[model samples]
Target: MTTPDSAAADVAAKQRIIKHMNADHHDSIRRYVEAYASKSMFHSRSAQMVDIDLNQMVFSCGGQQAVIAFDPPMKAMREARERLVQLDKDALQTLGRSDIPITKFVPAYTHPAHLWNFTQCVLAMVLLPRQANWQPGSLLYDNMLYLVPGFASFVARIGWIVFVYQPQFQINVMGKPKLALQVPVEYTIVVFADGASDSLLHGSLSFSNVPTQCDFQIALARVGRLEKGKKMKPDSASRTLMGELGLIGSQKEQKREQFDYETAEKLCVCSVGPPQESSGSKTAKCEFSLHIPSYLPATAMLPSVNISYAIFATCILPDRKVLQTSQDLRIVRETVEPIRLEPSRTVYFPDTSFAVRANFDPPTFSSKNTTISTTLQLYGLSLPITNSMRFTETRWLVPREIRWVLEETAVIVTGCPDTTGHLPMSSAQRILKRRKLATGREKLKLRYPFTRRGNTPVSMHSDGSGFSVPLTVSGPKDLSLDASTALSVAGGHILHAILDESNSDLNELQWRFAVYLECGLHIWLRIGEDVFDEASGNLVNRKMDEMAYTIVCPLTTSRTVTGQHDRGDQDEPVPMIPPSYDQVWEQPPPEYATPEGFTAAEAHTTNSLVPQDLLG
Candidate 1:
């Protein structure tokens, strides 16, 4: 029954779909082949979409072809994008992974605030290699480290290693989008009663972020150990190796290694090969990179989640002695999506003819009370001039008011997931939701919201134009709103100075950064939805309760990082307004205030403690 035209349309649509999937979402294509198509041939390395139809998609995975059909074939071409997202979600769940597009790891050492810390780290690196402790059974191993305060925390690992070299860290992209961590380390083996166990370098990772710190445990590069499925045991041998030599330092250090190996047996590892030892070094030296699997929920603090990664270099001796040292890992996520330079959106009412276009100045925001230059253009407002009577109609449509609302949705994760991937009792709280700009109805035809713009002489012109310039709305040849009519118009919004963009930290508590930021713009129009006039094909409007509801604008927000470089400036990080979502960030705090406890003098203190932001 299909016609030639319909067949051609289908062919074109399939080609476009295949090209997009191969270019942007190859990860999904790989997953599709592994999950639905060939399991052994592809090996999840790479996949390309060669062709697609309404019912199915054909992929070439690792030179192997796969045809994955839709459940009930797609009826239209536009449904392809949404269908792919759904399929990706299913693929991720099946692959036991999450959509964590972790591109790179960022270290805090580059920041000026960590200068003293970095200096000490450098000092430790210099002193470690020159000392006897870097040698096994030197007894004096880490003896000097104890004399200094935080030095032991860096170079010392518990187990069979005596002297250890402070490592230099770098990130190598194993394949595209994989952050392979490379660390160079040198260590002297501890000479036991029998002999030094075989030395192997491994790493474990943990991280934490806002509202609370999340205790997600992850182990990395556990190479050259017991068989892949076997777990590490904490025995007297691990203890004597800690106590007998200079290896034993703290009780906390002893339990961590055993716990990491036992609990994180199923942790994802992209590549696991024995460390390549260098023949040139005096000590057992190995320089290797670990291709850490993406989205491994770490422990410590990151922008998305406050989490840190650790390394556990273990050696199972002939006597089963284990050696190790761990440190806090600092990592930052790379910007995946580019920031919009000009966030211009148009709002159209299907029942009306006049369209309202909104333009927000790019990335003009503050920690609180951010002032922005905003403009709303009114278009398609007219009644046609008559052919015979030649009567030109002139009328005005005015905006009643404008306002701003800021919302914060905070999410908190609790216990580890069960076998079925169900959380025991994780929750989130809405910490802040308040209106930064409040507007009330005015007797004037046009009510323009006004606030200060940086160093500009005036934020608005007499005719309500921005930057103190004269502006005329394009309309009838001789029509113009006067200075008084335009003076009150505010094309921009102010994120009240007291308002804060969502922050990602609170020390000690086990919380993850799950707070999302959003803005709601309400434009109250003096004119309601338009009505059609049958005579001249013109649209007119009748008045209703204008203040009852508002036309909301979807706005895009970004953060500005100011740098004072000697020359120009460093490349600032892209501002990310975490995607708006309603998730539990924290368990709701217990209500402590009672009539007797609530007093006037303690008001300011109470305000500081409680999230008293008014509901928007």
Candidate 2:
């Protein structure tokens, strides 16, 4: 007598031996022969092969073994039918809670023998059944099926499954026809096709230790509810009987014909009235309008935004074709933010550029050539500051005025806002990261500072750093200049230059123009080219400077422009040379009076690619 424990031990021993034999590298041919001989004997239905050598080896020695499934054809059918009925019950219970009600479970019989033969190529024991239900006034139907997990491992039916019926199998001793089944009698296991025809349903569920005989009541909510049902077909809608059993089908058929016989919707017919003819030539005029919101801050003053625009126009026609034209147009708008006047100064609009774009459809386009033209205008302010009414000075108003064109390009910007107090030195370092002023050699020739006449001496002083003086304009006027001025510094100081001035105080005033110009350049460079770096918030208050310069330049432009004209009208002012602002600018604001807390501009790291003279 084989006890469950003995049977399990035998199976485990066979499995161990099979695994060992399979792992042995006795060559593929030898392995195949041994496998075939051993597997065939175990699978043979004849009892004669029960004691065969291969079978004995598997039973006693081989570590691995295969299982022989025994599911009689008649028994398979009966279980499948039972599963189908169970599915009908489950689905009815599930769908019935909704507006839909079960009408019947219709039996559908197909040639199981034919299906089984075809399933030989695959595996799956399946039974399909139709389910009928009623909706409001209509009868709805769906098809569902049950499948023995492993029997239909390869067999699949398309589009027929609406639910699955899983039934347990056990040997019946007192039954009329005793038969062996492939399923365990413990669990209800089911598998849906999931769009495949050759899928197996076996071993999907092992019996769980849940109480099977608990007298717990199962309300309608016990089963999962079906998704909302689709609208009933017009052919299925029904009507009430009048002295006769009027069928839903008849009513649906009548309604369907009524729907089919309906006339086509009457064409919308109100007349638009004949198109009014025009006497003049059909020369349609297209005027493009651009409306920029006032929110855009000015660029000249602090916290200002200066915008320049360029427009590229394109016309798309009825036939998926385009006619395009592009033009660069500069737009200058003053800052809408209010300004508080401190000294005397106004914003200046240097000749700059902006961007714009336009679109036109067929009606706006013409086969005849059309032209687009663009022009740029800059506008700003001018404010005057009252001096101590000092002694008068004399200078030249020459056509070639001794002007200092300190051309600086903003290399980068770290968009940090100013804090309530002093910014840490680290803030400046981040803004200046990776961006070094172009060396004089790498910068274009026309962009650098060189006197039109003889070479002029150039001196630069940043923060409290000593003047790099008398770097005599010793080279040729056209000669490219390269300066190695990365003198290490202690803190964040701004870039400033001193001209050949007699009095240092007067000299400081002369450099204001250059400082503002550098500020403008920096703003554009940082806003357009650099990433927003926050760590650089403490150094020199970088972000607020940008904002303040932008606002002040544009907001006070009217005063500045006026002052420039007024100064121009007066007798030629002295050709004031640049002055160093190392002390004043580098000085910590009154709020931050610590003498050592000077914010020195970052040392212009040498970029061999950029010319040093570019910022001269």
Candidate 3:
């Protein structure tokens, strides 16, 4: 039924598809065979599409033939590609998987969407207080808004937080930096009191910490000077107070480690909204970014240090009273997951005495990637050539197992507290998975040992012939109630936020991968090394498969470079919508010309439910 010309074209098309799939979409072929043929091959790794026809597609999954029939046969080769994508989608859904492809990625957008409604509300409250119709009203008739009757009275009584003609401000982080951020100050206050002098919105960021202690070293010293005409006995168990003199020896003097209660440093001073009334602009937008760089000895609260950031703002009211507020700034640090993968991605996972270099299936990897192809290889486990094992001619390992894990390592770094003798430290960890490379012991041949000594760093090399080992790490899975897993720069990982639930760390501490305090793929080998037995206090040859070699595999990520995103439209003015009748009462009509009710005539004062001021 088929013509010669058509058959030739079809053959060429089939070859192209096979080559492409085998080269790039090996996982897809494996999935197709599993979805269309059998779920039994789900765990089996190897998959290759060997043949295809109009009626059926054949593949080898895990060394077994899997034939999948095309119920509606494709009329042409071009249709094959489209149909395959659809099949993959269906297969992914059916198998509870995601379309998150197996590929390397780069950065993407960061900030959240703007709250236009809230923005308009704050702008109205500040720029047009008296004309604006909300919670606060004119200073004169503000108390009487409840007497007459209506919706305005309801809000006035309940929303007592905002005061009439009062100014309020809050500091928020606009963007994060390596060790700094754009501390954008937002103002939600009424206009400066009429004829108020020296009306400047001034503030400063202050740093405070516990007492600074000097670094000391332990050394042997006689305390004969402290003990006059008496011999002091040394307590072998005493870690301190050795023979009546403190055993601590002062080393090279370092900078003061912390601050005292009496001593506080103002890290940076900030003037919100252009020095008070510079341009007479009601909407006091913060044009300057408060950059808190990590240069000072007491700056940015570097990890393990106990410095705290507090924002202090001072304002003068009409009566010349200075009103000030100070709130703690939650400084969050993000861990750097920087990885470099150029034309080649043969990355080395180093350990003390062991090392492994792996070339991934996609030749690149990040937290966004799902799985690794069976092309992994390990090299050497070099140890220091110490005196004990100097004559060791050969090296051997029982080869316990290889484990891939998704682990979260958290630390609650307590700051230098005011009181001493308190060990300020806390930590917690959660493991999502611990996938093993084998179900039983691995049998391998003994080979020549690798050794290094004296200043030459170990674990930068590999000894054994590394081969591709099966790795089964996949995540960001979808389930109804399952908690979220980690992602990379490309995968929209929040990276930093206030913890939703209370944690043992700090009350509001949250971080990821800043310092060694990061979570990601952790791989380790359960192999034995020669160590002296503690019980016998002698060298023992006994081997045990305890966790020895570990490599916290850093995630390689790629990000898309994008211009300034989420820039609100400056051209369009926010439309002020009048309140409905449901929010108004018969006694006093609702006002719209202002957010603050600073009306000159008492008649327009609408906050009063009763006409108390008008009748007076």
Candidate 4:
């Protein structure tokens, strides 16, 4: 219905408008993505479910967001804009606006609708703090580059019109077309805390992407020393001390050899004497080193040294009126390297040369009342100057087992109180006591044990040092009773407890009482029901009897990172709703706002001046 001249003008107008819209899309996208980069954000790692053509560019789009992971030419935004620009041309001609360019009209109304969808997809990919993405200019774009594809160069030449007058639109551009996002997902990484599982393990390449071999040499041993003195003749028939030493603990005792003669000669010459009268007393020293293996396969099972250590406990409660208990414990050193240990996870330690015998007796509980018996043991031991070994073993390989020969020797037990003429307690005992009456606070008095080595003394205090019973419940609510057995050594302690009448209690009445010692380390025990019977102890084995409870108590009151690292970062904030379809349709589209020094009509009139007028 329009004239040929009008139709031609309308086509030109439509083309102009489409060009402007594309220009706006590009410029805005740059601003958006850059805002995300400035904040250094990260998006969730979840993959999206895309239904686009496999042959065409496709991207994931689900969960809180979706993103097109590709370079500039491959950007989904570019492809979408191309399709939308074509639609803009068709719409403008249909409107019969022959004189106005599609570029000018599209900016005034059509473009924002298409942009809203694109902006929505991109915003979802941004990793920012909750509620941070809404600010304007947080992101920017530059659509002028659309001309680089040659045939489309005319499109960009038109966009340059705005840049010529509006310099504010041209500043602070980013290099590399990266989809920088300010998503909050980076916070989740902290959940893997210190001594936690799957920590960052450093991996390096040795030119050829093959695994490098790591060799380990483990050696563990006990050394022995001897002192020589003239033998005090034995009343019964037995080999002389000199004869036994010549062969080194063998059945066929060899005669004293050249070394023995040399030792004897030296002793004889150094014999003590008084005023020329011979006293005939001298001494010679002998020492030897022995190697023993104490480590098993436990250490190799660990993923790395940065992991925290873990302990596995099993408590045995007597069910048959007759009280009995069997306890087997193994102690190994950890932290020469950091290692990860899951709380309550069972892991074995390797390269440990420490061993101890499980010494326990079945506690005799009075039948009249539910009686409790607790046994505490310290698993690290060093030989007295002359203490003998009854058995020994080297179990460092698969199905490791102990191998040994028990040897007895004569050496004085030093550092033991001469008054008692007995060895001191091997280590420290932080709380060694029992109670019967009930109170609001589990007010059991604590006793500490200590040991002496040479002149220096070693007391068993919690690593950070001191007791940490915060609020003691006189008795666990619902459960009739509770008890604990703990020892502190090498800055750590084994804490064990038993509960009674646990089933009838509500799990919600739980409370956490923590002990903070002077050393700044805090040990917390959760007094609650054992939802999982995995807790090893006496109460768990007897289900029908008076129900029982188990609480985690620290042997040495110290703070652990495990207690501090809870699931705080897992929560994510809901993002703002994208500009809606109805809103985008109803909203005013972008227009060239007049710059400070120029009026629109004045600007058009100014361009009307001839080139020659500028020369005057």
Candidate 5:
């Protein structure tokens, strides 16, 4: 298995190997290409190192390609170097060219010492469009190169030694025969490797007419700032006075200085054709491949710092005028991974006489419809009852409505702080504050009403025995489920149950239930009662009991196979079992609190004055 640290180390090792080869081993790479890759009958004019790996090196020259493999997979850069040296010696002996001198294959251009010391090598290169003012008859061709750091430079040059024109007459708009214009242009593209490092830079030039000689140079410059502590040069009298007063060591104002260095490098160039088309202007295209350096930071846009790279091209016209254009390049890093999670088990409410269990068919679901199963069993003290002179009756305990809710919370950074003393607020906070103000209206309405609201009531037999009810609830089909994120402001869901309130006028009670199922499942139940307050002439909601449960939801995964050889077998869905409770009561006695603000007589009067509006 590859740990994060090991993966990082692998990336760093590859980067070091690439930089060393591209910066200092250009000649060695060319030799390897000739010895291991080139054939005697098919000699290459120019070879550029394109890519390298543990197993092999790939090179390209013009349209031809070749690969040279290591005898044993290279574990590091040291082994790679030793293997290259051996291959070079073997290649020379095999070709019977052991006497060839290294100097005979010197590159056409080389960087001067001064140009090699200015700046770190360019990280990326891009080509921009040519100037629009060039002669219409002369055609200019542009090709973009994606350069990876630590790759050898690619060079190409083309010129015409002489021009022979054969003039042809053409009819003009005015019906007069006119001679067509003919122009000759020469262009060169040179991608140079940084002498200090394996970074690459591009240089290109085009001229209206063939010149005596063509030259291309790249000037790299770096500007830096320096801050120096203030230096004190006290006069003789002041120094003596300050020494006597013990003030000679006092601080002085600081000084600042700015300095810059610039260097220019002459790129290698090659001469290419004597006019493929002799009578008209022509366009030539060239392309180079660049691999982005693994160690380079991605392009960033920030207020405090800006780091960017650009490629500049200058065309020296036959008249000694220079035409230049620049293009910006971007560096980025991207990674991707696929993840899978195990399913969960069914969970039950905790520490209560009331029995309840909730579970989903498949604990984990993608964007698909899933069913939730719930079971309830009530006995002695948990069952509700209605009393009358003719008969006393007990009823089943079940929720009137249920809802699956999705909520989100986020950590947001405000763009800027307020100039005044007020604290900054995020957009989500502002919206929440507004909603809080309307809580009275929103909370009073029924949020999720039962689909079959007016259905006939099912009676429970009272033979001194407990009963159980099993129900299946399907989640809404419109919800979008995401398993890729943690449960936070942008990623969480909950289930809520609104149990039916006791309708008996004598008992003014309500219960609210909620379940949380993320890392684990937990249940919260709040028991509250409505009481009329005669002293205040209003109704009050008093909380009586709070219960909590830690439960589990069984996890499952969907199985769908798609292949000619698949057996197509699938697992059957698990059936939900009802929870079993040991006891039930018509009206469970409330846990008592001291009646501090009202007397017992007043409480009786308040209960008697309960309005019809408060009954439901």
Candidate 6:
């Protein structure tokens, strides 16, 4: 019953589907394998669709095969594509890769073991020992004379030789040894209440070797404008003592400035020691609470200046030897207060001009969209007397385009030279110098434009004296504006409108606009002026009319569930309608009747007449 033409058509359709899937939807296949196949203990590095039908899909990963079934069979290609997208999203959510984009999931090529490294294999075979007595067919020879051990030994020797002479490799393998005291967790200190409130520093310290006496102190240092190849000097008293003890030798005098070091707070006294222990190594728990000075600046690292704080713990041994350990802390300023602004201004252009006014409802916005309403009033329009005159009149001073933009600016350090010149002919020095330099001490600006929808055209009055146009604008859904900061950088939203007067036989006009800021702050803008250079394409002239507002949207505290749901048995029956109340309460209540008695009192005492054995 099978026809040759029908079979060939079916084969052609299948081949087309397979080719499309392999070319375009490779990422989806890889995601599917990572989500499902990985859970089944089949760790497939890559997957390709070998065969696909309306009801099922078969994938091959390095000759290993897997099949996935579609619950509702796809009837069209569009439906299949939609279903594939939905499945990919579900798999990403289940695998806790929701933040990762789909295009990043490329299939990894898995090479066969024999084809992994041909040169290494050849070298391994060359280094392998030859045995003439071993026969190829014997089980003993095949099991005992294997070349795996010899190849492994040769590779290990080569690796050791390559890494032994490299100092950077040795340092990476064996890091700088720490002191006897070890702190497992780093501490983050927050400066709040305008640096008036106190922050607590707490951690546990374990000692591998115990010392007789230990002194712990918390030091705060403010270092500024540190030049290259210059060392910071200690206090005058310490320098005098060192000089008196002949510790300072005759050396070249270098221009150096003393760093500001202060004992902000003392954690423990000199009498403090490690915790008492019976036999095992001892661990000490330390805690310090101190109020940070309001005059001190928050922690910041720049090219020329740095402000930092640390906790130092020093141990004095019996032989007058000292061991020390320290941990750095990070400090940040608190959130800013909310702000709101509302301004009204008017400007005059020429004989035919317009007055534009903008208003923001509520004035303050967060991550969500905010609505902006603008009104334009046109006046001094030359009226037409007759139909011929009206036909001769041309359109002039029309509002051409309106746009809303959100801009963000931040000041960061840039263009700093490398400070690793002290390393002498080390590989790390070369690597550090060869690394690309970061953009430092520069301003970061991000601009996002709002999309505009279609609106009605401008209409004129019956008298032709004046006309008004009212429009509404909103911020984009994907716009992320930062809160306003007075110290570092500022950000705000701006609304710009361009009017076309090309058809009119009038000279170009310039109008000044007012920008209102909080706390007696204001900015002025000049219209019909170019803010940037035409030939250089650089912002030579600054636009003072731009305004920045604070957006205070906090992140959601809810946690997303990334686990997969269990698909219940498909063969089980599912009712179209739920059971009714009457069906659920099918059992009726029993009717109660009083026992027949000669008198009411006897009826009440009927239970007493029963025998004791019957009651029991």
RMSD of each: 27.2, 34.2, 39.5, 43.9, 26.1, 38.0
Error of 5 at 32 (Å): 7.5
Estimate the TM-score of every prediction: 0.27, 0.16, 0.23, 0.12, 0.24, 0.27
On lDDT, the leading prediction is 1
Once fitted onto the true fold, the runs of candidate 5 whose alpha carbons sit more than 4 angstroms away are 1-18, 24-83, 89-351, 359-368, 371-550, 557-616
Off by over 4 Å in 2: 1-282, 295-308, 335-411, 414-517, 520-616
The TM-score measured for candidate 2 stands at 0.16
Model 1 shows how many backbone clashes? 59
**What order do candidates take by lDDT, descending?**
1, 3, 6, 5, 4, 2
Q: Write the per-residue lDDT of candidate 3 for residues 278-341, one digit (tens) a residue.
A: 2211223233334353211111222232334444443333332333434344433221332221
Give the deviation of candidate 4 from the true structure as CA RMSD: 43.9
User: What is the per-residue lDDT of model 2 for residues 1-616, given as tens digits with 9 covering 90 to 100?
Assistant: 7689866765565455444434542232132222333422211211111111121222211211222222222222223334323433543344333324355854333577766676742222222222112112212212222223322322223212422322221111112221111222222111122211221112111111111221111000000011122434433223444213643435446533322211111111111111133112222222222322222211211121112222223232223233222222322222222212112121121221211111111111125421111111111111121253212211110011111111222222222112322222344322111212221111111101222223333222232211111110111121111111111222443222111111112101211101121211111110111111123211111121110111111111122332343332142222111112222111221221112322223211110111112323
True-vs-predicted CA distance for residue 524, candidate 5, Å: 5.4
lDDT of residue 344 for candidate 6: 26
Candidate 5 structure, TM-score to reference: 0.24
Model 6: CA > 4 A from native: 1-196, 226-272, 278-284, 302-306, 336-616
Candidate 4 on 1-616: residue-level lDDT in tens? 7689866765565555435533454332222222322210111121222222212322121111223232334222335445544434543354333434245434323578777875763443331222222222223212432334442344334434533444222211211111111111111111112221222211111111111121111111111111123336443235455445562333322222211111110100011111222111212111112121221101111111111111111111111121111111122222222121112111111122221111112222233432222111112222122132112211111001111111111112112121222223343122211222322212222211222133112223243221122231222121111111111112232111101111112211111111111100011111111111212211221112111111121122112353342432132122111111111112222243343443444320000101212222
Cα displacement (angstroms), candidate 5, residue 427, comes to: 42
Q: What is the C-alpha lDDT profile of model 6 across 1-616, one tens digit per residue?
A: 6589867766677778778877887767877777766622122434677776678777765323567777788874446667777878988787776645534633223455545565554444433222322334434346764555564445444644544455433333343223332332333333332423444444444444443244443333323232233358778787767767778632221111122121122222222445444112333354444344332334434332344445455554443355556555455443332222232222222222333322222223447754434333334433233343233233222232332332222221222112321211121111011111111111212111101123334445455644445544344332222221122211221111111111111111211111111111111111221232323333333323322111111111112122211211222122111111111111221222333332222220000111112222
The parts of candidate 1 lying over 4 Å away from their true place are 1-261, 265-285, 293-310, 341-345, 348-355, 360-375, 378-401, 406-616
